[model samples]
Target: MTEFILPSNANDLNFRHRLPDKRLAPWVQCLWSMGRPGHLTESRTEKFYPDAGASLSIKLTSPHPIITLCFNKTTLIETLDTTAPCLGIRFKAAGTHCLLGLLPEAFTDTHYRLDNELEPLGLQGLIPVVERLYQSDSQQGLRLLETWLLHRLESQPPANSRITKIVQAIGALQLPPQQLGATLGFTRRTLERKLKREVGVTPGQLVAYARLNRARHGLLATTLPLTEIALQCGYYDQAHFTHAFQSLAYETPAAYRKRKLSQIYKA
Candidate 1:
């Protein structure tokens, strides 16, 4: 299940669920959480869901790529990490009109295929729909939500957790491929192949993305020195770290810290 932590019940923007589980599909969802002034605790299982364009939408707008997230379930359920809390704007399963007003294949049902590399669905796809909903009464909001999400989740099985586990393991690593592969109980080649099969990226690429995400958080949340941050995040040195950051985040670490993050303490 997708977990959401509501800081206050009295708050108007309470996000309970977005509905349906795709490999990670809620292509375009929305929530006030992105602009939240404070920080929130998200465990590793629900660690920050990082994508090339994971969002922070303030206004309702166009649909974006949907992501379906499933929880990790194992033989030893107690041992496997289970729940994660988050808040975001997201797409409703099979909400045809909500996703760019496009009809399904007209013959087929699904929008994305195994090899479909979707471009980012942006805010414009959602605003009109949301604005219309907002202008209506509270019952209308619930009606809109029901119309979008309640229709199909019952018919579909939830996504498997294997993909989530693979992603979590890869993202957890702070070492090179051989070392990380060993930690994940697979050979280097096997790890690479499986990761690509499940996640559409190589193990090394996943790690690189993960490393940049970790650095972004640290640079924003802590006053830790660059050298210390670099070492902790698995860089051979600050130079390599900076190079990777530039490639991944499109800015030098220092610049991102100063320009993008004025003060981002955890919630």
Candidate 2:
């Protein structure tokens, strides 16, 4: 699981990640809790880049709601005005459709209010649990949600093995799409359709996301120069890397690094 915590740098914000229960492990990636104190003097904004899958979240704030969010195709910028407690269930690459009963393509680059989508499917039982989440502690809320998922999974189909394989190959090998398609015994066209349906993005977009994801990790963990980081992440040059990074991250790599470091020092 991926956990993001900047306690020392930004005490107002905290995020926790937990492993999925064994029964739901094949379809779920992780369970997460994130939020900030409502009394903060200044607001915050977070930028989320494209990833491999989607999530169902309970947002505890004004216009309180539960929603299903598809993996982003471009950058997603979220502005926080008050205390925002969020609990999320991240789905595996090919898992959301079985639970949500919607094609992954239908969700790309957007979020659907859960009640509006799930009510038609007789999932109204979820509303009470969501209300309890807003009234109880985070752990209790998470446990309730987990239980609901377990019940939901009892009748859901298994994840698509081929889509999982393709995602695994993309993360591990970073091969060109055509070569990856060939390896999977698929033509490029066939592969694109499958990826769009299962992963919410086309092959080329996934590759770019993979490259940027690696660069993001390197930026946070290493002292390497920007040019070196660019090459290591498979970009042709620093200039090209800067363009892509800024497009997705909303800041140049150097600026992002500096801001992070400044936060640590100030803390």
Candidate 3:
């Protein structure tokens, strides 16, 4: 399990440490983990939105059009012309990569400060193929394409103890928003600020997503009962756990497990 929580905006900021599909043990998700603004090629007008952490993103479905990437803490985002989207990958920190053919920067902070053009840093030469897959309306193709893309990234940097500890705590227990803030040794407001910049979600949202993700993995990786799973994930009781599971996953815990079991049996 990773130390940080990845929030998927399109799916209620849903999180999973790994791929849920059984056949794809090595798959990495291809779409934005946070809220997806739109279809891959919908001519997005970004306005300096904040995110959880620095990660790789690619334009897999655009019309092979040139998308611009600019770094401007002191200038305007519109003053720059379109750069090549084929090599559009963002880094959250510096000192991440030494070679420029795969990723653009060695930095991880989202504070953009430099002007980068179309240049592959991690991806060798397979951007357009992803875009073609995206155009075909094949989500499976898109996901499979990312398995190839994620393989090219540098290994995740050594995790910070501060963040890792938080992840571990969440694993052991799930608490309300205020209590969670206190556990982190910060006010809810402060926790919210740091999470938005570094963690990419509020403490409450992270807890919710992390809990749901745990239950998801438990359903696939084991055959634990709903009550047992609920207690293991730190829910107060089965009722509360069921409420949370349904709120986030759009299905009751038992129904979800049944669906999974059904899929496996059918296969």
Candidate 4:
């Protein structure tokens, strides 16, 4: 997985992130918090890339806090409310199934209230504790959250080893979708079904997500030419890369890179 980095304008908001405890590292990606800064007078937008993962978010600023699970199979752009303080737990690819025993396919590309969803799994008890911590100290809260996750992990069944292997293989981008199934000893149909149930995407979609993720990292982290970044991330050429990125991100690569650079310079 790519290292998590806050946006260039993160300092303007109350944003923080913590790595998951070692015991929970395989399933949990990172814990994060975001709040509107008191001095800020306007709302902002947050751009989410396609990561083949899900996030459990709690709107702590609400009168009655509610937990929402957002599963992203494609890019999402959402406006942030200036009055809401939120906490999030991002799950690794296929990690929701391992940790929560929920099929991700049911929640892909949308958000849903998790109250009813978790109750069926006997995990509704966790909601109150999450709310309590959000109202407390950040450091202590994160520690407590990790402790809770560890205890919850103990009660869950062992994660499917095949899913773990599949996630790793997809991230590595070592083979095409067709070859990936044969390499893993699964027929194409079986691979599609398995990935959809476990990861909320087909093998082809997951591979595309992985490639785009690598390309995004390259755009933000290095000064390499577009063609180099495209080729490195498995695209056929620069045109192919730009088209795919624009289709999902709603902006061309040059525009994204320029906008981000402008933000950093202004910051």
Best by lDDT: 4
Best of the two (2, 3) by TM-score:
2
Q: Which wins on TM-score, candidate 3 or candidate 4?
A: 4
C-alpha RMSD of each candidate structure in angstroms = 13.1, 3.3, 12.0, 2.2
The 10-residue segment with the lowest total lDDT in model 3 = 72-81
lDDT string, candidate 2, 1-267, tens digits: 122323232355566667779977756777777775364435677666666666777778766674656565667776643367778787765557655555777653476666575677556767778888877666777788888888777766555666666776675546787787898689989999988886777887777777777887788788999999999988999999999888887899999888767777676
Which has the greatest TM-score?
Answer: 4
Q: What is model 3's C-alpha RMSD?
A: 12.0
Residues 1-267, model 1: lDDT tens digits: 122222222122223443333422433333323212232333221123323122222222233322322211111111111122222344322223223322222213221321122233322323344445535433444345444433333434335334344555555663565675676577878876655444444666667766776787777668898888998888989999999887665568898778644422222
- Record all residue pairs in model 2 with backbone atoms less than 3 Å apart, i.e. clashing: none
In model 1, which regions exceed 4 Å deviation? 1-154, 174-191, 261-267
TM-score of 2: 0.82
Model 3 spans > 4 angstroms off: 1-188
Worst 10 residues of 4 by lDDT: 34-43
TM-score of each: 0.47, 0.82, 0.44, 0.91
Please say which candidate is ahead in TM-score: 1 or 3: 1
Can you write out model 4's per-residue Cα lDDT over 12-49, one digit (the tens) per residue? 55778899988777778898777642334456777888
